[model samples]
Target: MKNYFDFILPTPVLFGPGMAERLPTELRRRGLARALVVTDRGVREAGILNPLLAGLDAAGVTCCVWDGVVSNPDADSVREGIEVAKRNRPDALVAVGGGSTLDTAKAIAGCLAAGVAEVFALREVKDPRASLPVFCLPTTSGTGSEVSYWVVITDRRTHEKVSIGDPALSPTLAVVDPLLTLSLPPRLTLWTGLDALTHAVEAFLSTAASSLSDLLVKEAITLVVKSLSCAVDVGDNLEARGDMALASLLAGAAMQHVGLGLVHAMSHQVGGFYDVHHGLANAILLPHVLKFNAPECPDKMKTLDNLVEGEGFMEWLKRLYEKYALSGEKVEIKEEDIPTMAERARANVNAQTNPRKAEVQDIMELYRKSFKVVE
Candidate 1:
């Protein structure tokens, strides 16, 4: 519990069932004429972009598509997006996909604004400039990239996950419409819902947590506890989907202010090294990290336990895992990789805010537990 903290919700959000259709109106109201729609191929292939594109056209905003973003986006993808931006010369960036697409758009916008040639170079630049007014429409309810100020990109050369945190990376606006998430598969719904829960839990337990963040994360955790299963079990449950969308938004908002913990620290390394889904990695490691941190924040854990109906926080989390069959995922990790990953996890930015200080050995053990490896 920090005695002092600053809360930020810099990006204005439009949230509802049909808020995505209002994106063009938001852009036009901002006087954004030429826009580059940044997204992934899967989103484009799903025809999710069709209505939005039509809306942009009807609004007379010239749109160019950059559908090159991939999962766990890397520096190379950002560079490619930069090239597209250069060619299109858009005044605004409209990111219309999941976390990866949103993150890539932010990187491209930040790099271009800072006049940097590479994405990571923005990290070294003095007085980083604000991104080019990014408008995010998230197709998934996790990662909260729609409201977060940080961008995680894999370093292709080092094979290490790096996060660039600056207010400049925050999107200018977020349109969170649960209808967009209706098409999300059950597995993703489960993973992303768990990711939101992890974000709320980690933020609530963060050393930097403030009164505002505590409120936000507590509500977020509660929403996930109540609605995540219904959302996963019945993907078309609009009410459940809406609750999850709000939960993700609130969790993202809270974590951006208070920061995360060992779950994200270890998960970032896993995603960077293994190209695993970020949400999936977080989901797998969250319960183990919570257990490790419980001693440091017993009261907070108890509060969370209450939020999940007092089933015991860890036990409830384990039940959620079992319900989703998360332990059965065919993720592999070599014994030799543990040391390197532990080192990176220790050095990760998210580790600094962990309520419990995790040494390299602690991280290694947690990784083993997540993978069920014989130690």
Candidate 2:
């Protein structure tokens, strides 16, 4: 944590029950006319995009839709999105869906901004900017891709889910309407909410944490602890949904400044190799990572324990995870693959900010511990 650190959250957020209906106004305010809507089939099929799309049309914003984004978005999907953008010539990209859709939009924006053909290539650019404004309307309360200047896309060949962080990748506007998440199924609700909780926990424990980030993540943690269960079990509880939505956004902003820790570092690789749901992987790995780091950062661990009113942070987290986790669910990782995954985890961008240093062997041990939990 540096006493002399900078914080940046240039993206303005519109948050409320009916905020999704205001995206077109936001686009028009920014002088954006033609739009390319990025999303996945699930969001579109769920009719979550209807209100936003209707608003855009009513506002006379010409639109084209690309519902090609997939879970754990890959570089190939990004290339396909770029092709769609080239043909559409839109003035803005409007993302309507979960984190994957939001992240895919940013990846497309980065590629187009850099005039590159591939998403991964944009990583090497010294300064990458989106050619057009990117608007985000999150349908999930996790990943925080709407406000964060980070995009995680998996590489097919390398099996590494890479994180691309650049200030310009931040969305020009984010419309976080919790009502959109009401239709999320129980399984997704649990996983995504856990993802938000992981974000707060990792950001709070990050070595790069500043006073401001610590304050934000603390509130975020409290909200998740209070709201995640109701949001998951009840699904239609508006207040619970709103709290989780706010928690995700707050944690996303905090992590943007301070980065994250080993939970994210390890989860990224697990998702990359196994196509595991990112949040589920993080939920499974978080307690294990906490155990690994508790000795190094007892005060921070204690802070979390106190915040959640647990006898111990590890016990609290485990109970929360087990409550929603699939019975007998196991990580789709093999012992033979641990070496490669551990290596990838060691190199993950999130690893750098971890309070406790993790060598390859230590990461392998964490993986083993997490993996054997089901076995």
Clash statistics: count for each candidate: 0, 0
Tens-digit lDDT track of model 2 for 167-259: 989999999999999999988988898899889988988888988999999999999888888998899999999999999999999989988
What is the Å distance of residue 211 in model 1 from its true position?
1.5
Question: Which tens-of-lDDT digit does each residue in 1-375 have in candidate 1?
Answer: 775877768999999998988888998998899999999998998898999999999999999998999898998999999999998899999998888999999999889989887888988988777658899999898889999988889997777888998987889999999999998989989888888988999999999999889999999988988899999999999999999999999999999988899999998888887788888898888877887998999899888878877587788778888887887245777788899999999988899999999999999989988874533
**Which residue runs does candidate 2 get wrong by more than 4 Å?**
326-329, 372-375
lDDT of 1 at 361: 92
Residue runs of model 1 more than 4 Å from their true location after superposition:
372-375
TM-score of each: 0.97, 0.96
The TM-score of predicted model 2 comes to: 0.96
Worst 10 residues of 1 by lDDT: 327-336
Number of the predicted model whose TM-score against the real structure is largest: 1
Q: Which 10-residue span in candidate 2 carries the lowest summed lDDT?
A: 324-333
TM-score of 1: 0.97
When superposed on Cα atoms, how far off is each prediction in RMSD? Answer: 1.5, 1.8
